[model samples]
Target: MKKILLFALILNSTFFYAQELRLLRGAITENLIVNDTVNETYSLYLPTSFSVDRAWPLAFVMDLEGKGKAAVAMLMNAAEQEGYVLASSNNISDSLSISQNVLIANRMFNSVFNTVPTAKNRTYTIGFGGGAMFASILPTFINEIKGVISIGASIGNLEILNAKQPFQFVGIVNRSDFNFRSMYDTKQVLNKLKFPNQLLVFDADRNLPEIETVSKAFRMLTLTSMAKGYLVQNDSLIRSSYNDFFVDANANVTNQKPLLATYQMSDMEKIFYPLMKLDSLKESQKTLKRSTSFRQANRSQNSYFLKESFTKEDYSYYLEEDIISYNYANLGWWNYQMQELNKLDRSAILFEKQMSSRLRGYINALISDNIDYLAADREPDLEALNLLYMIKTITDPNEYTSYLKVISTSSKMEDYGTALFYLEELLKNGYTDTQTLYSIEHTALFRIMPEFNEVVEKYLKGARYDVIEQ
Candidate 1:
């Protein structure tokens, strides 16, 4: 028994160590005249690899406060895992002064590249909340940036800038965010402009599910073949393609029913709800203006409601744009969520809810066995099981059960671990089918004790037993 316990402890410890992350801290001395004095402060993170000779692509992340270098470390770990380089810095100043922001960004970039010269021209920038505003404006000052990602930040007039230079841009927004309206409007404007940008607008109405969807989308973008274009041209089509890929990937895992339902719900709430409200407000305003008697009877009340709704709707749109800025600002929440979701089984939910078409497709691949669509290292296993659980709750049980069968069959050989894991999960959730439970127990026992015929016979005769050939 002690040996068994020791073995279990060793296995668990090995798993934990396999996922351990290491961080490194250092400072850069750059000549930036602030208050007529050249001062310097240290920035920190875990490099892609401990080796100094290997040059990795960089991601410039701002806004590190009490959060320490965890955000940068998360990105660096992801880069290391995904075979990229990320260079990040802490923009020490506060407030959204563009000049100050640009100066800090330039100094950080130069300082980071000076330490790792091979990172030049392969750098990307991510700005979060207020820092997103910095990312939008910083590009105008620095010519070396290859792409930009912004979250929950205000964009202002940044969309009007020329994107002919082939810089990729990705924006993440939430409808419940304070600046949601502005962000949505910015997305509309950018969509109209047809620049090589991708927008992930989430429904704030549902909290956990929405965040899960967003995180999944982000991961799929990183792990799939579609990421090649995202890394290169930053094309919207490529982004869209990735979205579709995730959707398909999830479909294969959960039988497409749950994803379809969630996609429909998100579209209704995130995309259509505000538009419907705006249309109603517009009609009400027109009617109130045309009818003098009605306007006179309740002028103040009518005007107040109309103006309030209109303003709220407008702000919702604005938030879409600003949200991207916040993402770029390197806010702890955004980075933390990314790190946490990356470790979970339901990470693909984040992608399915946030991305459409190709983006959705990329997420689907993460949970699927279609090796052609997925990278050599990426596979659907524990993550797919989590997605299956989520969909099982949101969709019809019978339909979900049938869907589960299909997924189990498709992934039976390659994903036996996930199947057993999810089967136990289903039992925990009150799915008490005797035959199914017995099958799961039998299969698990067989894999561990192939010579235990007596145990197999006992399972076969048990009230919860089922016989199914793999």
Candidate 2:
């Protein structure tokens, strides 16, 4: 027993030392030092097979919510399988000013570069939603970055991009994501500039992409590197990738999706033309494109685009008028529209579902934009601000800011009932910042109320305020 115990202890110590030398693979290692001077930290995932002997590819993943570990986890399965290092900063947030966010990203980038033996010409950045926008903007500022994997959002500041500095772009978006149209438009511009880019589409309504989707993106990056002669081409890898994509595209055709099938066929040709022969892909693309289903799909797409243009214009016009007039009555109409859109989401036709999802996403985007505009004015429009926040609670109940605003404004107006109502609603949404709840400007009066204390204590486990007897 003593001998066995000694052997186990030795094995455990060896494993620990191995991981301590460089970040461990397969599990997320949180708060790895990026900059000790700034006390900055980022989560890291080095594939379990990581070694300091050779340089490895790197991906800096960002989540606008600032959950570095969560972001790293999302990419860990993909990164491990694809042999890439993944890092995400704990400090970067969407609410920060552009400069602050840039600084945070720069610090992480420099730290990772200084610590990790990253392959030359293989560094990439990835982000979702606004974070995707942030990642898209990084290649412009940092010439060392070779590509961007932007999810759920399109490029930002296109003036910064030129043929002299083109980079690979891999966009993973969903049918219902608000930025689908923007991503489609950006693809057109990228093609015009002759930049290497690919768009991966999924049929979902969420922001973050699937792990297999991310893995495919990493594979695309690797293939692009090999095509550029930065990495040696492995015939086995080339064959495997082609087969995988071909099988998937053929499956689409089997399911009677000629549009998706044709896109996959065309994308495969673009991706593999430089790496291998494209005779098979060319034939498949030609056949799919000429099919009746393909023609119908094209027509459906064209009609959807036309309808979306008109709907977007109408939404913009109504939003402007509604905000200016502080039209609370329009809430019912918006609710009706949401239901109609939901019906379309359940439609049997894929195109109509895509259209309705786009419209709903557009409305939410418009609301967020208007809120920003209203909040940024020198003389803020309180009525408009209040109206928008309320709408936000309906649109995105998990976003706590709108509830906070409502509670603050209601308290200021001495409407204790309304204030208490929103406060409870905020708590129910999982808000636990007792200090922030008590410290919101114009909320001092309501903070001392017994009703407020009860609600706070119910959710937060401890009430900071004393309840005075009436």
Candidate No. with top TM-score:
2
Residues 84-148 of candidate 2: C-alpha lDDT, one tens digit per residue: 99999999887887778888888898877766678999999998888888888888778889999
On the 0 to 100 scale, the lDDT of residue 125 in model 2 is 93
Reference-based TM-score, model 1: 0.41
Most lDDT-accurate candidate: 2
Off by over 4 Å in 1: 1-37, 47-50, 64-84, 117-121, 154-156, 203-244, 248-470
Specify the poorest-scoring 10-residue window by lDDT in model 2. Answer: 1-10
Per-residue lDDT tens digits of candidate 1, residues 58-129?
666665341225445534444444444444444445543656656756766665555443444556676566
TM-score for each candidate, following the candidate numbering? 0.41, 0.84
After superposition, which runs of candidate 2 have C-alpha atoms over 4 Å from their true positions?
1-22, 205-207, 376-379, 393-404, 414-470
How many steric clashes does model 1 contain?
78
Q: What is candidate 2's CA lDDT for residue 62?
A: 76
